[model samples]
Target: MLLELRDISVNYGKISAIRNISIGVPEGQIVTIIGGNGAGKTTTLRAMSGMLPLQGGEIYFDGKRVDGMAPHKIVAHGIAHVPEGRRIFPDMTVEENLRTGAFLRKDKDKIEADLEDVFNRFPRLRERRRQRAQTMSGGEQQMLAIGRALMSDPRVLLMDEPSMGLAPVIVEEIAVIIEEINQRGLSVVLVEQNAVLALELANYAYVLETGNMALEGPASELHDNEHVRAAYLGL
Candidate 1:
């Protein structure tokens, strides 16, 4: 496994947000966690990126323990998180926001190359490179957020609800970008409430229910599951 969470738990003060959850992401594969709001999907992603401290269990990325590491340090170790909510710096230019993702790196030449690559992947961002991020539409901001994460050149990308608020067309575009990114060999751990899209994109799927692992299997299997169909697919 390239990324593994072993019986990990996260708490908010005295309340546990996630409990003994375990998931794995193999190299070059897209793995997804799907459930309703408050299912601990976002919390799990935060724990993996070191944004939330774990109360128990361990995290290993590329064979090195990373549970206690700082968030920036985790990014340096090749994990980039595109958090929930298009949290781009509103006042900054689109290009500036993208560059900030590489704050921990020192290779100027490679950073520039990565910036160009991001622009190419998101041509809308390139057209608005000099525009403030806040001025862009929701779909454009989502693209900028994803492009920014890719700027870090991470081996594993952790995304939280990349399709939260958008039209169907925009969601389809984001899905294409995600597939393209995975095809380029970056492993992904996606946390999404859109189970239909999640199951379609992921190679493997884990269903979370109020801080616990409810079910898991190959994506195709889950797609055909009765429970998943009733609860998530509206079928």
Candidate 2:
């Protein structure tokens, strides 16, 4: 595995958010965690990105233990997170926001090249490169958020709710972009409430309920699971 969360648990004050949750991401694969709201899906992603401290267990990226590393250091170690709610800087221009993703890097030439690649991947970002992110539509901000994460040149991208609050058309567009990103050799960890879309994009899937992992399997198998269909897919 390129990234592994071994029996990881996270807590909020005294309450456990997730317990003994283990997940693995092999190189160049898309792994998704799907669940209803408040299922600890976001918490699991936060733990992987080092945004939340673990209550127990370890996180290994490329074979190095990194559970206690600072969030920026995690980015430097090749994990970039596009957090829930498309957390772009509202006051910053698109270009500035993208540059922030590479804050830890001294490789100016490579950063510029990665910036160009992001702009090419999402041409709308290039069009609004100088525009404040707050002034853009919800979908555009989401694009900026994703492009900003890609600007970090990470080996793994952690995406949380990329389809939230968008029209079906834009959601589909984001899905295609995710596929393209994965095809280009970046592993992905997707946390989504949209089980159908997630299962379609991921090679493997884990289902979370409350603070525990309920089920897991190959994406195709989970999609056809009776319980998953009844609860998540409304089948």
- Top lDDT: which candidate number? 1
TM-score per prediction, in order, is: 0.98, 0.98
The sequence of per-residue lDDT tens digits that candidate 2 reaches over residues 1-235 is 9999999999999999999999999999999999998999999999988889999999999999999998978888999999999999999999999999888889999999999999998899999999999999999999999998988889999999999999999999999999999999999999999999999999999999998999999999999999999999989
Model 1: lDDT of residue 128 = 97
* TM-score, model 2 to reference: 0.98
- lDDT for each of the candidates? 0.95, 0.94
Of candidate 1, the 10-residue stretch with the lowest lDDT total is: 145-154
Clashes counted in candidate 2 amount to 0
Give me the overall lDDT of model 2: 0.94
lDDT of 2 at 33: 98
* Separate clash counts for every candidate: 0, 0
Residue pairs with backbone overlap in model 2: none
**Which regions of candidate 2 deviate over 4 angstroms?**
none
